[model samples]
Target: MDTDADARVAAGVTALSERSTERAGDEFTRAAWLSLADPRSDEELSPFADEDRGWVGEGLRWLVVAAVSYRVAGREARASRRGVEGIAVARDLQTTRSHPAQRACLDEFVADFRVAAGMDDADAAYRTAADAYREAGDAVDDPHRLATSPLFRAAAAPIEQVARGPANGEIAVEWDDLHGSDPSDPGAFLARRATYKRQRFPSLLDRVVDAGRLAAPRGTTEYGNDSFRCPDCDSTDVNWIAGRTLCLRCSAPMARA
Candidate 1:
């Protein structure tokens, strides 16, 4: 196995998951504290309090699921030679501009990342995950929906394991599965579910990436031009938006080249 490649993949996933998880936790904590600090009586706040709390709570749950999924995927990437090879392939695709499938994956990944970042409230998070889940169902049934490269399929295998549904004899991971059960100890319940989901399905990140790629733009680049490339990733999918230049592939801010 390529230990170095595995380590790099693990580190990247760990960093992304940890940072996202921390941000969600902070948001939830801040909201909770603010509610407590509010001068309004419980009766006065009751009308809006449940709705607000529900939103934050759902976002926190999804973030927790994301963190667990990342950890599992990272471990899987390090567990076998095939996983290492997959990581290598994925890295290569990220830097190469020759393949249409590569471009599709990059665009999908960027869209997914944007949605993950925008999980500011429960409704948004729930809708995003639900949409992703529905899309996943469709993609699984239609193999030719996206012109998936063999390399992309191989690279995605480890991550895809975490997204499989119970219908496939895998552990249940849909949002409904995670939310429907109400145990006395919510933390313990979530821990159990996370453990089960880790063994079976793809991570939330994987689902989003897969779903977005399934709906990938065909025959054209969204913002990419042959004249510009991201120095960090050697990708030509760079664009200027909102007064700053960004690499859609790697989300790196770069000066125009």
Candidate 2:
């Protein structure tokens, strides 16, 4: 992880994710947080896995890879196998740009960004996460624009689908809720051209922070391995999670001497 990107992203999230550490609470694995943060969790396409042997930063790396690809390779069809190419880009980015703990911070904020979205003030929460990535600049995406551009859509509930619903004026209401909705009002005409806020329920930040904190730890842990050490890269980190009992340092599943 690039230090420049790390510092900028952290600053943006910390400033926007105003919730104190007391509220954020608990250290979670990347997979654990993804289950709640990623809107497309049902697709199970996210690289994060609850029982996987990696850090939350791993997921941020994927998100970055996707963003990079979206900017450079054009949008990827999530349903297709070609999406796998993004994984390589992600690995290269993670190895080149981030350190372990710094990656943890990335993982935490991305998840927290969604966590904050469930709050009454969704804009503030999203701004924090979005700004962080934007500010990352060459370390990641351009600070002036979204890396995914407009082509990127949240995989689950397509925003396009939501926009297809009846326009504000088309839905006749018993009473005018917005002051500008009334035709006789001076601003009514201009209001007609503006987009109206839609209604959607959200989950609270505190309600979802736990799943990640309790998830298996990522990177090097206290548990060390003594056998099948690598000669080429000197890889030896142990991954003891149920789904992945391998070497984190080199992606070697089973070290054979």
Best by TM-score: 1
Report clash pairs, candidate 2.
Answer: 1-97, 1-98, 2-97, 27-213, 28-212, 28-213, 30-56
Poorly placed runs, candidate 2 (over 4 Å):
1-75, 79-125, 128-224, 230-232
Top candidate by lDDT:
1
Candidate 2: Cα lDDT at 256 = 47
Model 1 segments beyond 4 Å from truth? 1-48, 52-54, 65-222, 225-228, 238-246
Instruction: List, residue by residue over 1-257, the lDDT tens digit for candidate 1.
Output: 32232233333333332334233223333332333233133344331232212121222222222333333334322223322322233234345443333333333332232323322232332343334333333223322222133322322332232343211212223333432253333333223222333333334444544432211101123364656676666666643332344454543444455
**11 in model 1: Cα distance from truth in Å?**
16
TM-score of 1: 0.26
User: lDDT of each prediction vs. the true structure?
Assistant: 0.32, 0.28
lDDT of 2 by residue, 1-257 (tens): 23333333333223212322222121111222342244243454333333212233334332332222121222223212212332332334345334232232232233322322221333443343233332332342221122122111111111211121222101222123211343333223112111121222122112223211111112233234566553434555454433344443332343544
For all predictions, the C-alpha RMSD in Å is 19.5, 21.6
lDDT of 1 at 225: 65
